[model samples]
Target: MTGDHAARPGMAAPRLALAGWVLFDWAAQPFFSLVQTFGYAPYFVRVMVGDPVAGQAYWGYGTAVAALLIAVLSPTLGAIVDQMGRRKLWIGATGAIYALCCVLLWFCRPGEPGAIVMALAAVCVAAVAIEIAVMVNNAMLPGLVDRSHVGRLSGLGAALGNVGGVVATLLVLTLFVANPGTGKTLLGIAPILGLDGAHQEGARAIGPFSALWFGCFILPLLLFTPDARPIRTGTPTIRAGLSALRASLRELPRHPALLRFLIANMIYTDGLVALFAMGGIFASSILGWTAIQVGLFGMLVTTAGIAGALAGGSLVDRIGARAVVLLTLGLLMAALAGTLSLGPDHVGPWAVAPPRPDRVLFDSAAERVYLAIGTLIGLCSGALLASTRIVLIGLAPPDRLTQFFGLFALSGRVTAFLGPLSVAVATQLMASQRAGIAVLMVFFAVGMALLATVKTR
Candidate 1:
């Protein structure tokens, strides 16, 4: 469990350990892709709140609260990791928080007093816990691979995560969430678990299902991945953790490149967060897509994401992390603008002269165009996140990798609430979801400008 053991490049065990580490990404994504982004989240907006526009605004407001808390705590915990010389223990602790919150999502009900508030609370807790777990997991990266290969491994993790998302979303769409009209799954079969469509169990099951999936998949990492040896600091672990964090904060001014990268990450990562958090709601409200159609959309997006992560990783090894990030951000900006332009029957001034209101599920030309635009978002999002981590790793001092990675979360969270909160405010002000979503463009544009100034290795 020492640093040397963590760095050792053994033949058989390292491969297995890497696989186990990657499996973590796989196990963790369903909370996001299925439960958070594409599945249960939409249910909250449509069924729980009962008004798409207001639901979206409130959802964003709740997410902002969670993001603010996570932003404040992630770096503190990371600083502790550097002192403790351990990652897995913190990961387990946070993983428990995440999985429990997810399982508790089952308690969400329709029309009860404070039902919406309780659901938002579960979402807030789950979001915070998952984010903490992710940062802790990233801190473990240096233990898994050499510096030269970090980009590829990061890319592989992103790709595998998307693969897991695709599978999880598909399973829920086909097995658990029955079609709203027909009360049958995508397979045209009766809902499994005798899912009470009356009480919306079919959709609600996504919570416990995601919890089970995460617990099962994280085992590979817990069982096989290497951990740093226990260090014997003279002070308590909490005291040492605080001192380490304080010292890192004081020394940050000496690192201009790292400083710039964090600023850029804070802006753009917020934009990315807003995109995923609200994408499903956008589709459900504007496109009128049910869980089945939404699941299909998730599959397509995740599949594209897998390709984007791999391609971005290859480019990171050749061109540079900075270049990859800039490219991805540009694509994301364009994709989002296109998405914002389209509504049910209109596309930013180009109206479908003959609007097909009679048709079901993405029947309009604008809807089809929106679907096409989502593919671009899917492709760029995976690459944007994968390469951003590589950029931070390159800029950070090797001795302080975990501490710096924690700052990465801090960077993302610092303004994380701002993006969604602004969207919430905008949606409320304009009374239009499209205009509210358009606010993300400001984050991306500012982020790209800051990213351009960083010097690459």
Candidate 2:
């Protein structure tokens, strides 16, 4: 893989490899979307674990474990990849770990003894492996095409992933989650393909479904993507790689811009991830959203995300990554304000007259306004994060792409525990979901201030 390939017109194999790489996201997002975001997390805390507050604590801790593990290993792996030049191998192995673990999610069930612990381990391990895979895959960016094309490819990949999420969410909503009160699926018929409603299998089945989706779609890049040329003399190669990794770690403080960008990203990205990871659970617990409602909301946000990613990617080239990111953060502040301001009835900051409590699903005008603000926030978040990838690619020194990207992933994931932990702590302290969400604004504001000084060019 080399940036030189961008000069050549119409390379079918590389295109296929790119598609295969993007498909990895398509394969992977279902776990994050359906299981973590929409269905399983809430199901785990509410039904499986039989407690919402304890569930939030457990969920936050599980994510913290993964983040800490990834933070420890990702940078070293990145440095080793740059030294050994075996990015593809690392990607393949880690991706396999992620896929298989996702499939194992099927075993988690309500009332199963030790199921929560086992599933949390699986989830954490899978999360760590997925981050490692991303570290390698993203390192491939500078080698895939010219600087001009990186944003577009990244955006396209994100858009495709969102599409995948939308499709998967819709399928699960239509097939698996039955409305307990109405006794009807989202599609207004019995769940398709004769899903057994007797055991509440719809929610459990997402694990295997995600596994299958990931496994089937991830093959092309393994076959078609070019692997880095191997270095000779195995023992010497390993020794040298270790030395190089050590050097990269030792050298980190010297690179101020890159270092600052990473630190800022670490803070903001953690908050972003925490918000999404816990959003559905909060809604289900507080707003009384069902699985069907969760699925529908996931689809809506995902659609907005895709649109934002495309727009952000293009805008990054014109307005610069710094501007795009700061703007996004500002929007996030407003969105959080709107979301938190809404009481049991009204929406958007404050209201002299709150709506009747009986109205639901953005039924009140204020609730509708809050949802609109939230949708905008989601859109900007998707775009800003996607653009951040391009910025990282541009800022990383040419020869150490993998090592730098590893640090990038590490920084993003390492502090991820803090946001959720804070949320968990705040939720417990206040006994309100809104208060927990309000805590995230501090992270966003501080990160934005730190990022404002970064030199994008």
Candidate 3:
């Protein structure tokens, strides 16, 4: 009836094991931070696709596909892994695929035949692999530390992930990803390694950079972290895994708090995912920011995320995960409203900052407002994500931890496509990126309402 690990309930894992486990987040984050959100995605939309509107739609569709795949497979894999045990092997297998896919992205050069298709395929596969790997990693959490320390560990991991993101973004901006107009990086120097800004080779290098970062950082976890023992010797059979999954599904309704929390997570995580997926593209298309500018903004957001996650983790034990979630959600809604209100010339129809031909980076009032709003969004989002994980740990049965973590991934990803797809559809219908992004507000509001009904102890 206990979580599947050698560590007894309430016993702390060894410090080495704990450090290794926490470092996995640092290892895994660059893929999301650089490739998915800040660096490669914006490049894909802006330069490779060459029309912001069409590119956003295309990117959305691709993200939807990845989310749908994650939704369908995560729970099933969780069940299978629960039967097979030893999460490290699964993590290694998926991490290899994820890393390889990222490296392959270097081939997706603009104007190359089939480059677009190749890029989309690589991204979609990598996304799915990483999400599955993350599910397995999350399953390891309940076993890592005592219940009392769960929130702190989870929050610390998220904070480290943001730190990784910030470092990775900075690296890309400094070493590669030059401003096309000036042929310079953020540091006023040409991109190192002869990376041509005109050919966008610098931007394309984000893929390989992320891959290298992941490969290097993941080794600590594999080398030092202890994995759960196998439930039984040898490979687990598909039939047995299916039976276990069915049993878990049938038993779900008995835990009303867990179910409600999952549902709420399902709704809100979609909004969060969509927001992350679109944020860079929105900046490029709506704000007319260049890749370097977007990367800088990403650094700002990620720096804020680190602070928020650390604070949230600290508050979880004191205020409770539920309170942290609620507070962060409220903050997220307000920040999102502020985000949707701003444009190049105006903030919520005031027309305050007109276009200045002589303007430098982030000089206008509108841009400044956006930077402030984005900081808040970053803070609230990091807290929201970490708190939600703690909420799941609080609500799930100790015995069924891995199976439920799978369900947790399912809940987070099941309707994930709807978030991106709705944004794509709304953007197409309204021909306005702002209108499309505004759709996420509804997801946040509905999730808050649903979360309120769950009675967390």
Which candidate leads in lDDT?
A: 3
lDDT of 1 by residue, 293-373 (tens): 777887888888777777887888888899999999999889888897777667889878433544566667886787788
TM-score of candidate 1 versus the correct structure, residues matched by position: 0.90
Number of clashing residue pairs, candidate 2 = 0
Q: What is the C-alpha RMSD of each candidate to the true structure, in Å?
A: 3.1, 4.0, 3.5
State in Å the error of residue 175, model 3: 0.5
lDDT of 1: 0.82
lDDT of 3 by residue, 1-457 (tens): 2233546777887887788788888988988888888889999998899988788888888998999998888877877887778898899999999999999999898988999889999999999999998888888888878877986897688678778888888988988999888788888888999999767688899988888888888887777766788876444456677787788778889998899889999898899999999998998887888898899989998888877777887899899999999888888888888888888888997988664655688888888888898899888887787678888888888787766876776788788988898888888788778888899999999999999998876
The digit string of per-residue lDDT tens for model 2 on 219-309 reads 7766666555555435676677678766766778878888888999999998898888887777666555667777787787888887787
Which model is ahead, 1 or 3, in terms of lDDT? 3
The true-structure Cα RMSD of candidate 2 reads 4.0
Could you tell me which residue pairs clash in candidate 2? none
Give, for candidate 3, the lowest lDDT window spanning 10 residues.
1-10
Residue pairs with colliding backbones in model 3 are none
Number of the candidate with higher lDDT, 2 or 3:
3
